[model samples]
Target: MPSIHDILTKAVALHNGGQPERAAALYRDVLAVEPAEPHSLHLLGLQMRRAGCEAEGIALMARSLLLAPTLAPALFNQARALQDSGRLDEAIAHFRRKLEVDPNCGVTSIVLGNEALARGRLDEAERILRRAAALEAGGAFASRLRRALERVTTARGIARDAADPSLPPGLVVRGAFRDSSGYAHKVRQFVRHLVDAGVRVRLVDLNHGDVDNLPDGQIDPLLHTLDRPVRAKAVLSFTTPLVVEAVPNLKTINYTVFEALDIPPLWAAHSRRHDHVVVATDSSRRAWLQAGHPADRVHICPEGVEPLEPGRVAPAAILDGTGRRLADYRVRILNVSDLNSRKNLEGLLRVWLRTTRAEDDAALLLKAGKGDGASGSIRDLLARLTAETGRTLGEAAPLFLVEGKLSDTDMMSLHAAATHYWSMSHGEGWDLPMAQAGAMGLTLLAPDHSAYHAYLNGRVAHMIPSHVTPALDGYRGRDWWTPDEAAAARLLRAVIDDPDGTRLSAREHLLEHFSWRSAAHRLIGLLGGLDAL
Candidate 1:
């Protein structure tokens, strides 16, 4: 094996040659061999920033700066990382420090001027950019410096996602309203918060079709903002990347998610027409960045969950296969899902077989959505399991799978009928049903991967183990995993054996941490001042 110095030298060469992924692997190798190598630390941090892992990169570079305070590259990279993260004060402070180290650094002056301009420090911006203009008269950054100078007097104060749309000036939310697909559900949920947060949002119903469980006509007149006219300079589109429109003068922010290991390159390419990409989780953000979206233009704003529907009580009863009502079970473990491949229905069924017995008073309530021959698909899954494991679902505990067209009120009733909600999904991108279940006081159990870590902690729910596997199907997210069926089985038996009502007590924490009001206010803050929204 080469020494750490030799490995680092090669890593730096690769890093400079624009092979960050390969260079990053080598830098990690250097860290593994000599954990506190400051050079390796800072270089790896820069690579991380390039990949849009700003927080991680900043932390790594901070550590490197602490270890090697005199490292100029560390300071420069750390300053860039902070700038990429939109921390104007810290970023400007670091840029000033770098300029102090070398007052004649034209690139440093240009960036400092630009940031100062963004902070509305016109005099400071003009002075710095003038110096930069003189120093880099005909250099590579001449045109960029010229642009920065032109914007100095015109620049405004920084907001997360400022109202810089090229059209007149307003925000329009474009998404499908007449559907209840995952995309539609999330869009509707976000609109609820945005409107509640006091935004005068206009709507542009996409009306594209994938799933249409929701009825036509406005579900909530206030939520739809149905009264507002549709004419705006900015659009917050909650559709997939393929439908991204290249409308000039409109600042488009694509609000979407990905459960797969990655997004299609074509989708990623199309999304570039939009101004920014906002997602609900860091994993989703990383996927967009990895698929070639700009690091600084991608961001995370976590989704919130509330009761299934406020003030609407579910129907009184739900019958299981054995004619016993769902309420009859001592412990009703629920999973509201569709027949999607990534849901890992096979893993769920296997766990159900491995753990519970017919004598057990617990039941698994699957409120699966109706799809094309969705009922027959369950039979096919059971048949596959029987051939593979030589055991049937009947030999285990009662499995109650509910597949039907349910109204929102009826769905709330389904949640009311369950004691617990669980999933062994291969992946997720902010699971709405699971979040709703947890919010409704269902003792939640989920695998330790993807968006599950966003809310559920050990104190709140039983978290199962997960192992990284090849991305199922063709998901373009960084990684996916298979939940440990054995571990899930063990948890199920423990919960079944000892029913603890205290598990439901943590539901309040979920509400407190992920309220619609709070999440909406955050989105509002990003768009402009809360009052501006």
Candidate 2:
């Protein structure tokens, strides 16, 4: 057998070469001979972590540290593992211990600074990053540290501005404001309402791109103002609440949209980080309460809808993939959703094909987006459906898959062209498109549950009969509603029979209940209530 030194050397080499399993076996062999060998135990712990055994890795690392308390590498590795596991507070403690062991560890300082930056501790991040810069002069690490320090300085300045009393009482809205996403649309509409109501606001677009082709011009001025510090009365964050943990010394409202009954442990923790949690519907509020959040801290603030201008006509013809005009169809049914299992496109397609024949002169226009791997699945399903129905593209197949980044005007045009807006979503945080379509005076066909219940009524919507079912995908283990196929088919036929009356009623009911003015009033009241707390 080789000596411990030779075995340790080979294990280290293997570990560095990314052969963690081989390295772990060698380290275990070394430990079998000398059970308290600190190096063997530390290296094995890191290997175990790499192999996806986090708890075992942490245990081994702890034991190694017990044997050699000043093991700098072991301490650093443990801290990194803890941080990766979202045990940020524990990670900070471990990093502090590592610094104590090796006071001049520049890499440790940089890591600590980065962790601080992630946690939104700007002052601490700047301090540690400056120390890292001093320790690592004239190197890549030093250059990186300097850049990080500059960012920290800028962030600190922004935080200061956020807390400034000199500026008018305003709101700083942070979210994916530029994307063609539901969240982005909600933020855009809400910001528009605030501005229209004569309130001061600044937008922090987190979508990481230039704001292009957004529907409203109000977002234009805010885009150029992103680089400036935001001095606002409050920060309303539409992003995940986990971000609020980094933003200290401000009253933060966590604006979240939860589709399921049960909240995940991680999300619940993030929700508690904010001063208040604003949910889109009463069902969402109940979910937070069930997840152990304080009832007083969770408030219901439903989203608003902006209808398209009246008298706007759809294009005379929409070009299909082959550039052929699909204008022969008499009726258009529009379904806009991020193509995913939750949207239940599979079920929707099945029901549509089963209900309407090719001779019905109706087209199902699927305006789908936002799924990374969902396009392939959608194509496959469409192909299967086409074969089953014996329909060719654009003629026998009455389905058009429209996928791209659509402008607001383009979206409104699609809604205007459609005779009915349809969805069979398993769940919804708040189905923005459904509400928008309703506001646009388009007849709706959706389940009468979740966020739909907040606005959809018999007066406006043809509520499809649905049964409760287990949620799919990210909402696993929670209950959601699935629309009855036969009932949906009946509703689809009913809407086609009386399109104008159904559209008028839907538009009236949606405008009465889901207006931006109402949402903004509720929001302003909620912000005022936060002050009393």
Q: What does the lDDT come to for candidate 1?
A: 0.73
- What's the residue-level lDDT of 6 in candidate 2? 100
Top-lDDT structure, candidate number: 2
Residues 1-533, model 1: lDDT tens digits: 79898999999999889899999999999999888999999998888877767788999999998898767778887887775454545766777887888788898897777655533457777899899999999988787777666544322221112343432334667677556566766667778777676666666666333344566443665654443443454567787765543333446677788775566555675566567777888877777777778887777778887644433555447776568776778899888777876888888988887778888989888876643456688888888887787777777788777876655455667787888889999878788778877888778888888788778878887889999887644453246778999889888888898887435444787788887667777777776631223
Cα error of candidate 2 at position 526, Å: 1.3
Which runs of model 1 end up more than 4 angstroms from their true locations?
Answer: 1-170, 210-213, 223-227, 307-312, 370-372, 476-478, 501-505, 529-533
- lDDT for position 322 in model 2: 60
Top TM-score model: 2
TM-score of predicted model 2? 0.73
Give the root-mean-square deviation of each candidate in angstroms.
14.0, 6.1
lDDT, model 2, position 481: 81
